[model samples]
Target: MDKHLTPGHVICLINPVTVNLSHNILVINCGSSSLKFAVIDPESTQVLIQGIAERLNSPDALLKVQPLGSQAIPYINHAKAMAAILASLGDIPIAGIGHRVVHGGEFFSASVLLNEDAVAKIDACRALAPLHNPAHVTGIRAAMENFPELPHVAVFDTAFHQTMPPHAYFYALPYDLYKTHQVRRYGFHGTSHRFVAEQAATLLDKPFTELQIITAHLGNGCSACAIKNGQSMDTTMGLTPLEGLAMGTRSGDVDPNLIQFLVEQTGRDIRQVTDLLNRDSGLLGLSGLSNDMRTLLEAADNGHSRAELAIDVFCYRLAKGILGLAAALDRIDALIFTGGIGENSAPIRARTLAHLKVLKPTLDHDLNSAHGRHTAGRITTTDSALTALVVPTNEELVIARETQRLLQP
Candidate 1:
């Protein structure tokens, strides 16, 4: 354990009901209207089960639960879904519960065990993450109600980025506003980026502190981070999650004045504009079709003009973000791709990197397509100036590991 651990605060969760160090740790990751969970044993880091709750707060919300290496089973409501999920755990004793919380603010810099005061603290910051916090609160409450005997830990997405220096995090806003409301660039996807960066360092057999990395997490919600010395020097996401690479349904990096312009021109309410930006923008808005990249790629392959434009724009923004990140890092030791689109979409990866000719990143097309989760290899040509890799992010494992570490007495 690091000497920075607060005595009596970091609870050691070595022994569970049977005094055995090997215990099943439950990890829950909740978004605005979805909850993704996994169960893992600390002894081997083996995933025992995994599940997801989608469309929360909707009458037609659904959940898909799956045991380790098994097919998923869908359920109607989150409550019933959670019940079915718990029952599916069979007789496995739940040692602890770890939750992925969105915004931890300036107060929490590391993972902490959830108690009443901590829960209250989380509740107080609902305004900071209007979409994410309520769902997190709901999931945590459900977990508490269902398993009153277990120790629930809050593993924050913002925690890993806490190592960011003040210059990188602070905004040039009014002093009182920052001091009173905590308005600053609080980067999300810290968990995924941190996990991938560490994995990349290990794969390269290089010390983390010596590596300058730029990690692109390109899923439904996309973000890039500039990691220097294993710490977040800067990230694409700002005060909100809606600030990074153009996402599935988000208008990432839009002009701030556009909001006012749209409001004046369309005479629509702010809520409507917010909904448009958050729910109806990005690839879906651009392509005039599905938000999924695979669907867009298919449409483009079949001569869909809008889809082609959408793909081009997405890659353009991605490459630009990478360039910015590279500038932040001074020089890039490795450029890693992770997330749904990043890991699986070889064409997307190739297109994104092709624009980086100025940086001399040569992509080996064959390796990019062959690489998958658990396989880390260089996709860059031997003579390429920069190292390009495909690394799968493991945020769940980070959550479980943090839970075990914080709970260990």
Candidate 2:
């Protein structure tokens, strides 16, 4: 543990259950309409308390708290949600707070301790992530107001990917657009990508800075990253999150002209067209069923044609993406799978690996079937040149660790 940790406060995980009394890190992930809060031990990484306040600012809003006899209660606003979360934490000694900000744009290259300037910079980039940054600002301010003195840190999702080279980020647009408007690829889910990459390096028994890795985060919002020497070289998501692999309801990588074409054909405005692409497309659009991979997998097994197509496209795109990311590396050290679908879906991993025949990756049937959740985590046979691994990502833990590191005196 760092020398900064002191017996500042007593931790009460539950009435009967106790842990080593130390300062905690409170992590807040404020989404558009929901807020998730967790009180975590920065040293032990034990979550003392966690809850989500959903449907905020509405009469139906409720705070659903977890595991010490989980229950729900009325909490109708973001500010109140923050208060409720902290109040429930009770005697847990909170050393600092960590807030997840979705986009830092070109302003931040790493996790930062929030101050007036930092908050201002994050607010200025609100246009870059209108749906998320505003809520984040609200949460940060509310947390700040509630705690008053605890140090607050902003952990950006795009900060880890800011190391991407110019050629990797720049699109075929006027250079002035980048200079003036900062119009370029700023990958999303970077925290998850970076976290899993670090885990992959550990699993490979190599220093993070010495490895070249491709990490695919396959949750509702998906992105693949190519990390070389502990920094991002290239990533799939560009500008907005709508530019990568097909996601839950997001149509990734559509023709730039398709938005206008959609408007002309449907006689809808650009806003509706944008919403169509962002919210109504992707797996849902392809399957016309659920946007969930598990649902699609089961439906496909039951002979649902559209479900099969969705899964096929999803796997194909992922395979191509893993291969494409290799372009940014001198040599591939490991290919890591993380997030929801990546960690749990054995079928998806197996199906995707089948398309990587060029890599000559021999799938260890038993390991792959077990979902690679063990210590080895390798799904490929020993003879394969390129190995595949499933390293479950912990973005909140990354935020907590970053918060603790920056708070060190």
Candidate 3:
């Protein structure tokens, strides 16, 4: 083992010999309607194969494998999807399985080797993440049944933000609510945030623990995270993914009273109001157009007023979230844009950064316009007070690495 200093100046042991290991880890990410699987070599961080089974439990169910081709399959549920995914992998020897569990509650502060006890703990958190954890549980159970002999590790999306201080994670609610029900914020997109922070550190040639970075993960689901010294200090998403910056469908950070107001005005039930906020809001509701940033951008260029307003609101809210998270840090080292929209939408990035002129963020117009899809580097000028970067996130690689760490001697 070789001793190395983390960005936070903590001494840690690095097992250099693990670099020669030929272990192939399977990474699984299960959503409400889809399951994505990847076979990655942890040592090389190379994805050997990956695929998805989408529209599960529906007539349109389809299983698509890369390097192969798309095909229709009968994936009635997550368990069926898991079975199909395993069958698609054929005879590939998998050393371990890594599952992306959305919420760990307070039970897990880091990744853990899954067992019956761990599964119970995860089941307990299903209420905390009603939209994600149950699906994860189904997938985990299915995977366990399929590969009973393999070591399965659970990598949580909330695990990285477990480092957040109480003041940052707690909401201004009744003390009893928090103590009795754990009604506090637990940031999501932890895997993406942690991955981009490390990539930013490497790109900046700085210690991970020495940098204060604000990462904006904009996609169908979006969140902003304030990472200081390789640990999450604060983040935008609250108790659920629905509390973050304006996402594709989620209405982020709306007033608590709005729900009651809508219910009273429209005579709709609480569940209906909740569905509106979570599914029919954000860019989709605002623009009356597609939820995709690309579509909104094109519409805005074509003189669509609602589309223009939607983009404006999205960028403004995103910038505000970034600036707000900045308060958690002593000094800002870099602003990282990642995920589907953050990495690809140059106009959106420019618009968001435009509001941060007070921070003296200088963007290289060419670099900002160029799509650095899978590359990691700075998009801001060298002399800018704040560095802006577009780093592609690889949460699967993070899960694979975590699995490798736990399985190693």
Q: Whose lDDT is greatest here?
A: 3
lDDT of 1 by residue, 307-334 (tens): 9988999999999988887766768999
**Superposition error at 155 for model 3 (Å):** 0.5
The CA lDDT of each predicted structure is: 0.80, 0.85, 0.87
Question: Candidate 2 deviates by what RMSD?
Answer: 4.9
Itemize residue pairs with steric clashes in candidate 2.
none
Q: Model 2 Cα displacement at 92 (Å)?
A: 1.3
Candidate 1: C-alpha lDDT: 0.80
Q: Candidate 3, which ten residues in sequence have the lowest lDDT sum?
A: 1-10
lDDT of 2 by residue, 82-141 (tens): 888777777678889999999999999999999989999999988888899999999999
Candidate 1 ranges with C-alpha deviation above 4 Å = 1-21, 31-34, 54-63, 68-81, 372-375
Model 2, position 204, has a per-residue lDDT of 95
The number of clashing residue pairs in model 1 is: 7
**RMSD of each candidate relative to the true structure:** 6.9, 4.9, 6.8
Q: Rank the models by TM-score, top first.
A: 2, 3, 1
Residue pairs clashing in model 3 are 7-209, 8-209
